[model samples]
Target: MPPRSAPTARQRRLGAELRKLRDSVGLSSTEAALRLKITQSRLSAIEGGRYGVSAERVRAFARLYDCRDAALVDALAGMTAPRRRNWWEEYRELLPAGLLDLAELEHHARTIRTAQVTHLPGLLQTVDYARTIFRQTIPELPPPMVEYRTSHRIKRQQVFWAHPPKPYSATIHEAALRMRFGGRQITREQLAHIVTMSERDHVTVRVIPFEAGSFPGAGQTVLYAEGTVPQLDTVQLDTEHGSEQLHSNAQLDKYRTFLDRFEAIALTPSASRGFINQILKAL
Candidate 1:
């Protein structure tokens, strides 16, 4: 098959797992390709996410690598299955590629956790709030591009409306709750929506008040998407340029610790609800 010019995060992750398996087993590319009856170039293409891996190939790699985790192998095979075009594809030309990839990742997430220091989480932002945030972009954006991004962000919240909703945990700092984006009314509505969302059994919203005291990594926004297995988990960070994804075991571990620390200092769901109410009252 011809190689893809651009691969999604899911595709790259499958390829990374394949390479990880080979590395864990201490097999050189040439040696593994010879054992699997394939060329080194093809293996490299698959590992680099330039080639689409077939289900058969995924299993073959599992068998050759001496991996006996039936669940992990099945999960990998599922990734190899033909994928339908997601909603994000509709705006592929309008939004940044990283933003599109983020939408796709959120669509497939089983469990989502996030920590926000300033801006509200994208998945929970209201339309007006999102538009205001977009308008505030440094150097400013063209009206059309701002509209496109605002619409794209609003649509991303649909994950909460899935047939069987995925579990979502958000740790929002007190400062973000008081930002007043789009003025007091818009920010109030956004906070209300967050409160309503938290009432669901699958959703939890916690507040990290200024009174929480000191903590590490307080200046970052983190969205952790948990996959079927821990090995497939991903951590995404928003930057001035674009989205950055982290999947290496070390990177994942570090972010996991960040979430743990922040979550520890956050208010419980009930308290968080009351906290939002207090903020709304002040507004």
Candidate 2:
């Protein structure tokens, strides 16, 4: 296949890992290419994610690198396999690349865990909640753009709302539920939606009330997307700018611990539902 002008974030991540393995063995690009019996430019392209690598080739690279972890190798090889076009692809041109990348990550996650402070988790927001948030975008988005963002966000939720949904856990703050994004009615509806979703078989929604006191990463949001195996786990964070994806062992470890701490201070699923219900009643 011809080289893609812009490879997806996941694809670049796969290539980056391969390059790290080669570096760990103290091999120069030329030497690694020579060992793999591929041209130097070909090696560069593969490492840059401009070219696709096969599962067989990934295994061969692991062997040459003397990587002893079978599980890690298997996970890496899985990344090399071709994937089907997901629903996110349809909005490739309409939305930001980060949004598409997020959707793709969630599509393959074995389990999903997230926490949001001021805003509800994108994967859990209702149509009105999502539209209200997008409608307030900086510089004021055009009507078409707002609808595009709303549409893409709703589609992302399909992973949980679809048949045989993936295991999901969302830790939200009381302030987020009471923010009144579209007004009292909308916020009440959003909270009610969260209550409904929490009752789903594969979903768990926990809330951190103001009474819980302070917590780590005070205002930041976190989305931990577990891969088929531990080695492929990812942590996606929402920032003042666009979203950021973290794949390193250290970053994932830190965020996982952070989330664990956050959840510890949060209300239990049952109590959280009651808290939301009370808030909805007042609204």
Candidate 3:
């Protein structure tokens, strides 16, 4: 088997910061590379998130860019530094790049808020529910692939319940509640699971009712994760082609607004729990 690819979230973040700094300084990669005494190709690699740059090199680049804040430079240096291997590494070969990226982001996130229109959020999905969803994919994935995907998803859910658990809030649409992924029994279990999860101090689940009608989401799901440091939140969206990360202030604001609007239309926690119980009893 081939060696697994490295998780690109950290590298991608470093690349983004480098580009931002360069742009802020009005220097192209070639200009920056000339000043840093490195070849344009190497600088391009760093800015493109394909290569890892050393902390010293990062500081030097910050200095060359005339970035005045020592703390900001130090934070970038820390972010660019190598991270210890995480258990998710073991499943790299079995999971999609997008899923792996999401898991890594979750591992580092101080808080995660998600809005889903058609399905339960992965962090809140039961094993059986995940398996059913995977098996229903259009291309008809092989049984082994389905099993692997399901297991990978379940493993990702561990972050929500890990020691010193991270905060998670999911706003799900009422449409998702009506769609039975596995069967009546599995749907019942899934709803019960949601009730149990909502009991956690750090977990909040809200439901957007069908009657709410035409909210900001408009058939999209988004995840906004707060990083270890402020100003490092990441917004992720799922598309038909793949996943896209949004980091710019405008993009992040757009999603944040969307989430806020969705929340406005969503049932409050107490009402959501009541709806969930109703579903469970009906099932």
Candidate 4:
């Protein structure tokens, strides 16, 4: 099959995991390719995520690498299945590739955790609140483009509505809840929506009040997407240019600690709901 011109982050991640397995066994790319009975170029393409890999091939590679973690092997093999048409595909030509990758990541995540400082989590933002934020884009998006993104952001909330809904936790700062993105009315609606969503059985919203004061990751917005296996967890950070995905063991560990720290100071679910309602009432 012809190589993909631009593989999604998921595709790249699968390749990276395979590469990790090979490296862990101390096999050079050339030696590994020779053992697999494929050309070095073919192995290169697969490792670069430019070529497709089948589930059988993934299992074969795991065996060749002498990997003993059956669960990790199974999870890696699972990622090699045929790609299905997902709702995010419609925006493939319109939005930044990172945005689509993010939706894809959330779609497959076993659990989703987010840390937001100045803005409410995208999945919890109301339509008007999302549209209002989009309008303030640096270059200033065209009206239609703004609408597209707003709708896309709203559509991403589907994860919360799915059967066996995905578990979602948000660690939000008091500043975010009070941002007033679309002025008072929109902010009020957004906070109310957050309260309502947090009440879901699978959703958790914890607020870090101003009294918490001077914490780590104060200005950062992060999303931690848990995979079927711990080895596959991914951390995504919002940057000025685009989304940055990190999955190295160290990176994963660091962000996990960050989330833990955030949660350490955050209000309990009941108290958070009351905090949000307090802000809503003041508005």
Candidate 5:
């Protein structure tokens, strides 16, 4: 098969893990390719996520690299399964690849944790609230584009409702809940929706009140997706330019610590709901 021109984040991550395995063993790409009886280009294509890899091949690579972590190897092998068409595919052309990648990441995550100060987590955002936020895009988005984004975001929320849904924990700052993006009515509805969603058995919503000032990761919005194994976990940051996916050990470690701190400073779920109710009542 021809090499993929644009590999999805999951695909890239699988390849990256394979590369890390080889690097840890101190083997150059050429040497590894020789051991695997493949051409240098073939190895590079696999490492670059341009070519498909079989689960069997992944296991073989793991053994060749002398990796002892069975859980990580199993996680890597599981990622090699054949791809299926997903809801995000329809927006392949209309929306940014990063958006689609995020949907896929959430779909596969064992658990999802997010922290936001300026905006609510995408998965928890309402249609009107999201559309209103989109309207503020610097260059401005067309009406149709805004609708597309809003619908896509709503669709992404399916993960929360799926059978045996993944556990979701969101830590939101009081500032985000107070921001009235679309006006009082919309903001009121959005906050109410959050309270309702937080009532679900599997959903957890915590709030960092104004009293909890100067917290770590106060300015950035982060989504930390826990994969089947910790080694496959990822941290996504919303940046001015676009979504940035980070999986390096150091990056993941830093974000893990940041998330822990956020949770530590956040109000309990019940208290958070009451806090939001207070904000809603004030509005």
Candidate 6:
């Protein structure tokens, strides 16, 4: 099993609110459970943030505790609803915890902005492109493992088509456009695909030209996401060993600054599309 940690910020907040409610009503867990028509153990788990509470149950508990704070009750209800398991969970055995956490954050984000310097971002990669990249990794992954990882990446792309699809903005380096993933013919097809995808209303794709030289973001890739709640915005940095998630206010601020700087050095959407077409023709 993965090592356990303290509850997350959201979980802690929920637990504190529940504890306050119980105190206000002067009710013990057993008494509260009896009033709410649930077992004492269940109430204990909910208050401790070990188990998710149901919206209806949250309402019942709030009423029982004489919680007249309508806004707080609504917030609690939203927090307790069943969330879909992250798609990356299927790859739990193969991926590190940080990457899995980033995937979960991506699934829940309302907006995403990214910059890629050396390769196509996973969301934009074609199946052949993904396969080529995976097969080239050193230490030689087994064929089945490589296939599983590629399939997992494709599934991650489905988030773009989900109900109320999240908006995405990306700035890709020109070198990535020129790199031949699975050879020239496949690279041409991938470039053409990029042009088509960029035209979608929810996606913005820009190219940072080679001439945009030595910029603040010339070497690294970064992904920034805005969560459903304002406090959840996070930045993910991919490294050789693993990925890292940055959620501290200071780190998020720095990434936001980096994004603004990178955007300034990239081609406009229309120009980027024309640039991609030019590369496709040359290929």
TM-score of each: 0.97, 0.96, 0.92, 0.98, 0.98, 0.74
Query: At residue 42, what lDDT does model 6 achieve?
Result: 70
Residue 281 of model 1, lDDT score: 88
lDDT of each: 0.90, 0.89, 0.83, 0.94, 0.94, 0.79
lDDT per residue, candidate 1, 1-283, as tens digits? Answer: 7898888888988999999999999999999999988899999989988899889989999999999999899888989877688888889888789999899889888899999999999999988899999998887999999999999998888998898988999999999999988887898899999999889999999998999987669588899999888888899999998899899999999999999998998999899999999999888
Off by over 4 Å in 4: none
Off-target runs (Cα >4 Å) in candidate 3 are 1-7, 69-72
RMSD to the true structure for each prediction, in A, is: 1.2, 1.3, 2.8, 0.8, 0.8, 6.2
Cα lDDT of model 6 by residue, 1-283, tens digit: 1212433334444655687789887999889889888888877767777667678878888899998888767766777655455567677778556656666667767899999888988888888898898898777789987898788778878878978878999899899999998999889878888888899888999998999887776467799988655445778888777677676668888889999998899999999999999989887
Quote the lDDT for 175 in model 5.
Answer: 90
Winner by TM-score between candidate 4 and candidate 1: 4
Cα TM-score of candidate 3 = 0.92
Candidate 1 residue runs with Cα over 4 Å from true position:
none
Task: Tell me the lDDT of candidate 6.
Answer: 0.79
lDDT of 1: 0.90
Q: List the residue pairs that clash in candidate 3.
A: none
Residue 254 of model 4, lDDT score: 95
Cα lDDT tens digits for candidate 2, 18-55: 88899999999999999889999988999899999899
Please give the lDDT score at residue 234 for candidate 2.
92
In model 1, residue pairs whose N, Cα or C atoms come closer than 3 Å (at least 3 residues apart or on different chains), thus clashing, are: none
In model 5, the Cα lDDT at residue 240 comes to: 85
lDDT of 5 by residue, 185-241 (tens): 999999999999999999999999999878896589999999999989999988989
